[model samples]
Target chain A: MTHILDIKDLVTNFYTYEGVVKALNKVSFHVNHGSTFGLVGESGCGKSVTVRSIMQIVQSPGVIEGGEIHFSPDSDNGETGIDLLKQTERFMQDLRGNKISMIFQEPNAALNPIMTIGEQIAESYVFHRKNQIIEKILGLDRTGENLFPKVSANPLFLPLYHLALHRPDAFLLELIKKVPFLRNWDRAVLHTAIEKSVELLATLGIPNPDKIVHQYPHNLSGGMKQRVVIAIALASEPVLLIADEATSNLDVTVQAQILDLLKDLKKKNIISSILLITHDLGVVNETCDRVGVMYAGNLCEVGKVTDLFENPKHPYTKALLDSVPKIRQIGDLKSIAGNVPNLVNPPLGCRFHPRCGHAMAKCKEVFPEMTIVDDDHEVACYLYH
Target chain B: MVVVLFGVSVLMFSILMSFSPERRAVAYATSAKQIKEIPILVAKYGLDDPYHIQYIRWITQIFKGNFGYSTVASSPTLDAIIKYLPTTIELNLFSMPIIITLGIWLGTIAGIHRDTFIDHTTRIAAIVGWSLPTFLFALILLMIFYSQFQLFPPEVISDHIDDFISDNPDKFIQYTGMYVIDGLLNRNFEVVADALKHLVLPVVTQVTVVIAILVRVMRSSMLEEISKDYVITAKAKGVDINTIHQKHVKKNALLPAITISGWLVCLSIEGSVTVEFIFNRAGLGLLLVKAATQLDIPVVLAISLLLGLIYVVANLIIDVLYAVIDPRIRLN
Candidate 1:
């Protein structure tokens, strides 16, 4: 029931040639532990901007005006929560691929061209599980004793153990000297990492993972590339995975497959939560436990999927839901009028006032605050207030 | 096919023009008897026969490595070519690394920091260098460094191998024709050091124009690569900016520059003429100019053929290199 990640009154702005563009103003949402939370909005609705802010991926000219992104690490002992927004970039980097990984929209561009898919995935495991891999290689576990009885019995390695403990620097120097010809040893390490990556890829329903891992990103199909990207994100067993329009570039069938893969992973990997950012309301309906609707640069509504779909409280959310074609419905599919207001010089009060059907005189003069309607639903509109 | 056709035509034209009797005497002739003497003069050059026969005889002699005698040098045309080829190669070998390294490095930096003061300054320098003729730049460099500062030697310092061997025969064979290479091969640190110091100004003069062209090309290519979606993806993946530059940006950007560099190498054989002249170095550029001015048809044709051959070979090498640098370029 506890929230794994929380964003409070987040505001992100960009300094442009025209003026300060408020990309995200007072936007707030949360992902409960082990729950898939969907952030659905049109382009420029601050969905991507919000997730990037959590990952501290925003570049200069785009500034975090105010916010806090608190992440509660999923640990057996229940460690203290960390505020990601306040952390230095170095600290964020330590947490990024390890604690929170992201799968971007374009698979070809998302993966590095110069590196093979296997090497890049292996790097994640190498960086985050350095100590674990080292221990596995050295045949020692955390207790400072040999895990393998055969390894412990080797008389040749006895001096190595003593050297490692008594003269660690000398041991390292000796190791470095043998490294130029350490192909077998290096292969052993890399092979283990690749095996782990392949296993992760297979779990994502990628056929012939063994063949796929050896290939470069360009060699794979679009869907395969996406699946490989997903495999990489899942490599470190992160607490949260951000799929930034991960399925947008894929075909409809592939999109369904990718969605199913994510759902399966979520069920199997009980500790991980997904923050799915997309513009598709139908996708959110199928996969998300809860949905947050955004308009312009503000969160217009946040509610349980069924409630938001059946009874969207905010005028903007209602209009968005109406826009989706329904097979059972008789009347024409309603579309929201007007484009999203310019962020540089947004409408004075409610950004959607220009198009909202229920816009009152006050709606154009005063901004609305999010008002709780039920334990699970919240709407940001004058009607709710 | 075009190159081959052009080359054949040039060969024929050079031979015909070289063997033609002097026009001045023909222009002054008043009688048939005076003109009768022209056939003897033409016969002396073996030009009184049919064009095809004359071409066949010339080509046959060329195939035998007898490129005919140079009217200007009074030596076998091939001998003149062989004597000058090494000097040109040596000059290029000395100058190329400087140009490429400086060009690529400065260009990459300028492109990465576009719109900044450094970018503007590099742009200005490139424009000035590229706009000016190579001979003009060479002369300016010669005047400033050689005539004014007395920094360079003004000509190559020829050390006889016989003298070097007799005085220090042990080290004589080690100092290759290229003093720099010889210094390194012999492990004569002082000789290597001294050769580099002597090499400074001429190398600088040669590199100036090359760097100007290369920097502009490399900068634009790098800037284009930087804007690619892959770069954004790299940033999103949290790859460090410098690593992205080294592994992705530089590698990708170098492709176009590498192709251009191959052509530049062939071009340098001809391009460095002015540079060689400024330094009074005996390279093919100076040879080419002198041959052209003196209408030394045999030498001119030989040099042109050598340059054309170099251009074709360099292009072939570049095509092969493309497959190595970019996996997308599949060799047919």
Candidate 2:
């Protein structure tokens, strides 16, 4: 199997007035190509920070101090992938929402309130797909050499339109553009973008996409807004979609619907791979092929979802799996014994040894590297070593 | 809006009516030499009548466009407003744009460069501008520019330009009462230059004093907006850093500043009394001061009504602007 993303020795910290909050501590993980990968952890356990670091969008005061995130965008050349953390911010800006898109947690606050749905979706297309859209416009203009007689007849306008579409910063088109009536070409080009947005909305199964495109975010329900947000992320047809708790805020029915939509998208080959960051164990169990269990900024276990659920290795992973109640059980719902450690002053060595039942003297002395115990299953514990 | 204006007028009338007929008769008396005629004037205007009757008489005269007379200007109250309003309007026209653009620009840089030297300097400047007394600021500027350098003078225009307009009616048409505008119409750039020179200090004083609140509003609003989830979403969606700040964040930040700017418009148009008085410009604010001091009730009442009307119109314009900037707000 080939890996799509690999994070090695990633360290992220938040500089604050109090002290440095160690958000991510040498966290390492990977997502397989064409497979759904889930990272599951407790509420404050740095799951979001790991993905945010990948996209290079961590807020201020939170800095990626050191890491090497090699992204294999071209599946055939996975061995020599480019290091994402070493790339320039300009390169990252071009890659984000184009090669690797992200969906945020809050649906109500994700979309801009003042912009129309069509405009919101079209923004990504305009930013990353301008050349594609411009080509589309040129194709439309050359349909049997008679796309629109008015535009085609004006030979002067066509060349200027080409120049306007390409070198928009030039003063030639700007002079002509200042004439109020010459704005027709702008509307025509914008119409192409809006049409593409309508198609994207339709693919998301939004009803009456043509009408919905003209509506604002405030006009939509919670589920509908999430769908719109998803549609926007899918605007550039990224190779990897990072859904950061995308379905947590919706009701049960809507959450099920969204999850099914994600599953359906994968099946239809509409999306290549998904890196879903969620806290719901049920969500991870049903959808993910592979899972990584994290405990207070450290990845404790990584394995196939079925193996991790049935025969969990790391003590924390075992405790986490035990905490979930089955459909028909005779025993009490087992909860973890101790609180998750604070990241600012997390315990030295293994972060979970204070609560682990199998605490050894070495568990308090040194942190353990990930060790493969079985085929395609790894655990970060002295027991595995 | 009309009801509100009516309410304001009634309130002012009741306050004026609280005084004795002899005291209220000051509105009718042309001069203090006619002290003996105070009773006769009171009788003629029914100043001693019941409250409702006095209110009805005053409201009737206002509706009939007979705003008594202005002893200060030696003309009708309406005529005095018409003659003096242009100077105040011109002063605000120059200062309001400077106030709005400068405030928004300073606030945007301050918000973007949070905790940096630029932010600290702008914040301190805003604080000083806000805390300093308006009259003191105006006086200091007047002393520096008019007294020290003698670079700029005060009042509406130089005596020569005023004389030119009054002396040559056929040669230079007074198309508008504002000399800067009318000078251009008449192709008299000298008059325009003279008028603008006199405008510099007052406009400076007005903008410096009034822009502080707007900057504070804009800065805090910008700080709040850039932290919104939509901004993060924009960054996530591969938007260029410049567009995220200038377009998405700025458009949201300007919403609060728009409300503050509405107050700015009214504050300027009612014509900063301190600015007009310190500069000795014959605008409506100066006229207002003269009217109030002389107990010229008709002139004071008319000015109050005009201010009430201006507030209503400013509110309507603000509503329109809000609808334009924010899609969540719709105007019917």
Candidate 3:
């Protein structure tokens, strides 16, 4: 079966003052449909970088050197994915928040502080769902209190409607838009977008969304703000929702509520797949169906959560599992030896070689390839090979 | 606001009053003969009275709309301000919008196209603007545009138009002292055009001098906003880079710029001295600076209080604008 999202040999590098920091080293993983794929790693292990590269939203000083993000929403009937990296900016612009949306780590930071909640959520619709909103506007009745009858009353209505239908950046639309009160012709589309925003907010379980729509991001509680952020992501009904440490910043109770909301949305088939990035192993154990363990810009292991937890193959994965402090049972948690290697000049061969107990001469000379160690389990280590 | 203004006036009055009574008496003297009677003039204005008594007397005079006499202008302080304030206001009215919008637009482009040729070009412009002394820049424009090309004369209005307005009151009424506005009100477009022509160099000097700081402030603010998580969130939500910068980042970035701009307006009031003096335009800056050279404390005290009022008003507007832009600041 075709996976919902597949990342192949993704290499991302950060050009900083010191040197080229090799942040992501030929990382490859595939997230299946209708399941939570958790990527757990320490801070700066390139988990966020991986998803940012996928979304093509990586800030400057960092570049996606080489990568093929194969995204094909239809997983059941065998449709080969399109390389997202190869798509044009316009294509990517539409694809983002429409097909593949992201829920950021800090809800406090994710929502625009200056913008009202309605405007923020409506932005997604305004940017990507113009055509959809236009279609909805076209179906609105020509009479009786809808914005359409009044819209049709304008002299430039037909031309503007046609221009809006053809391209959002129509020259005529811009020319006539300077005088705020004079631009009555385009109000129908804007009205529809706002209406859709309120609907999306209500669907995402935002309380008093009608009033909340007009309120700024700062007015909301942490959980409500997260819901607003989630509402913005889910505005266009994205098939793949990438939650990048989304619940990491919230309190325990809020985190649980958000997690439950995400799970419920998934169960209801509102979202096709979730690519959850977090360093919390417990969170992964509870929520994810599959897990990918990352270390020093490399994906060391990926498998079903059960298989990976019960029988972690890679030495790095085993070390990571052992490091997690258990509830009321740990004597002293065992940490992997050595600092996370400086990615600018990571160890030449396998990045884990310096810390791996089973490191051999060959392991120090060559980076190992992924080798299947068990059913639905894969590990990138010399021992596995 | 009233309390602040009153405090500003008292502070300014006391500083001016610190000069010896004989020296302060010079501001009250009109002629060489009167200069010789400094002691008599000092007693007449109660110049040697205790500070509070003198301050109370000054405040009572202000309540009666008497701003004392300006030795520099050879007129009352109120009349001098009325004559010069409009010229300064008109000059700024033309340049302020251009300075603000152009600086903001350029800084935004530089920020968004960061580290590119466009960004570098703007940085160079900002540096040139910042480093070039106002008088030198104004003189260079004067030499090139006024002397060499004879394009714009360095006067508030051309001699003929000035004479025409003064000579032909029926033909060209001075509805407002601002020659440009009055010219338009009087339907004398020639006067308006002449006023604008003469204004070009002074406005340019003000813009070139005042704009560097604003651009720097705006550029840094834009850069900070660009790195904000909301900006990334906007980007991740499929918002175009332009929309993200314009709608989301620009509004958030404008808070610091607003404060800087309020300061710019205040600074420009003081900063216009060089431009006005060089350009031969009678504005508060040049008037106050000339008064300072002659130790004319009355004009100095009057203009200082006026500037304080303007600063307070500008800050109030800025605070209101800030609260409007960022709701988080509303409560505060």
Candidate 4:
């Protein structure tokens, strides 16, 4: 299978007054095309940092020290992927929320409070789909007065609109933007962008989308707000959707609903793949086709979800799977022995060595490298070697 | 709002009443010829009555627009306010916009480039402006501009332009009691230029002192908003950094700065007193100082009431602005 995203040896750090935090220490992973990849880890184990590093949005004081994020938006076309880390910020912007988008953990904080739902959704469309919206606007029959006839009727924009309809790439349109008085032409474009936003909201199954578009984020419920945030990410039709704990903050039913919505969207080919980051093992088992177990900035194991759950390899992954209680005849819930280490000064080798029941002398002195153990399965442990 | 204004007026009136009735009666002496009839004036006005009666009488007279007489201006207290208020208003009209816009602009730049040289420099400048005494700053500006360079002089207008306006009533009309506006009304460019030239030193002093607090408030507010999750969402949405700065960060930052802005305007009004005094401009601030020093109770009481009213109105406007900026505020 072709990889949609290939991240190798990604290193991210946070500089502070105390010390430089090794947030992501040579972390390596990838998401395959048309498949759901779940990255599961405990809190503060670099799960969020890993995805944030891929998106190149690690917050201030956190920096991406080095690595390569090779993203091929058109994965099946046999095209060479571009190293996202090397791309200019302008290029990254074009890729983000267009080719790749992220849904944050907190729906309440994800959407802007002051902006209307319609305007929030419309922003992404305006930023990345201006040309498409303009083309859609031109397709309308202009024989009579349309929704935005005021600009068209103005003498200043009469000729401009004619060119925008016949030849959108006309130099006159570009030059007209330089003229302060004539720049009202773009208002028609914005008006059409709003129209497209309404359609996007309707697609998300938001009731009475026309009315909801005018309402603010605070006017919506938790589930509805999450849907709005999803609608925004889908506005540009991203090829890869990163759901960063998108359903963790929700209740059981809402979480189920959101997960179903994501699955439905994946089935509909709205998003080609998803990078689901969560700490819930149940969520991972229910949705992910593939899983990567992360522990303290290290990927301990990678395998098919069924294989990883049934035939877990790394000791950490085995312990993680053992911790989940079955439905009927369950023993006491088993937790891993030790806590996640501080990344600033993690253990010398094998970050989990202190917690591992099978820790050997070598495990304490040397970091284990990832080794392929089976078809499409890899593990980083001395036992695997 | 009415209740708040009333409360402020009561507080001010009670403070004024603390002075003995003999002192309050000095307002009724009216002219130099009547100076010897202080006791008689006190008796006629009932200045020595019970505190409640005095309070009731003062409230009623205020409602009736009789603010007593100002010995300092040699006119009615209300008349003195009417004549002097325009000067301060004109000064504020020029300085307030500059202070607000520049403060927000500089604050945003400082916040966006935080920990950089620009941020350090702006913060250092803010500290100096905030700590420097207003009168000392005004005096220094005066020494540099008026005393040494002779570039811009203080006072409301050049003596010749003042003489021209007073002598030729047919040519110049004081429509707004502001020379700038009146100059435009009469097409007298010389009057407008002279008025603005005299305003430079005072307006500069006022803006420098007031902008310091505003910049600090806006800077910290912006830093807090810039780190919010919504901003990260905007960045994730591929929104341009500049758009994120203006729409997401700056708009949210302005929420806290709104309260500070109101306070800054109030401070500017108070700072105008020092500015006006040093520059020899006949504004409300200068009038206030004269009134306070002479124990001119009527003038002082009227000025305090006006200041209270200004605060109430400014706070009301800030609340409205707060609702406009944050939709959640509208829900309440």
Expressed as tens digits, the lDDT of each residue in B108-148 for candidate 4 is 89999999999999999998988899899999998998899
lDDT by residue for model 3 (A1-385), tens: 4699889999999999999999999999999888899999999999999999999999988999997899998877587689999999989998999999999999998988888888888888778867655655555343444322121224457566766887867787787877678666666766666677777777777777778988988899999999988998998889999999999999999999999999999999999899999999999999999999999899999999999999888888889999988887558889877898999999988998998899899988888898888877888988867
Over the full model, what C-alpha lDDT does candidate 1 score relative to the true structure?
A: 0.76
Q: Which residue pairs overlap in candidate 2's backbone?
A: none
For residues A213-282, what per-residue lDDT tens digits would candidate 2 score against the true structure? 9998988999999999899899888889999999999999999999999999899877889999999999
Pairwise DockQ winner, candidates 2 and 3: 3
TM-score of chain A of each: 0.86, 0.90, 0.93, 0.90
Q: What is the number of backbone collisions in each predicted candidate, taken in the order shown?
A: 0, 0, 0, 0
lDDT, candidate 3, at B146:
89
Better of 1 and 3 by lDDT: 3
* Positional deviation of residue A194's Cα in model 4 after best superposition, in angstroms: 2.1
B1-332 per-residue lDDT for model 2 (tens digits)? 98999899998888877778898786566576878898888888777889998788888888998998788899998999999999888899899999999999999989998899999999998989888888999889888888999989988899988888789999988776998999888888998899999999998888888888888888999999988999888888999888899878999899999998998899887647778998999999999999888888888899999998988998889999999989888744
Interface RMSD of every candidate? 2.7, 0.7, 0.7, 0.8
Q: What is candidate 1's lDDT per residue for A1-385, written digit by digit as tens? A: 7788888899999998899999999888888887889999889888888987888777556899897787897634364478887888768766767888888888877777656788667766655664455455566567765321221223444444445444646746466546675413334445567767777777677888888778777788899888888777777778889999999999999999999888888888733789999988889989999889988889989989999898889988888878888889878888888888899999978899999889999889988988999878999899978
Every candidate's lDDT: 0.76, 0.87, 0.87, 0.86
lDDT of 4 by residue, A246-352 (tens): 99999899999999999999999999999999999999999999999999899999989998888999999999888877787477889998787888899988999
**Each prediction's TM-score against the native?**
0.84, 0.94, 0.95, 0.94
Task: Name the top TM-score candidate.
Answer: 3
* Per-residue lDDT of model 3, residues B125-151, tens digit only: 889998999999999999999899999
RMSD of candidates 1 onward, in order: 5.4, 3.0, 2.7, 3.3
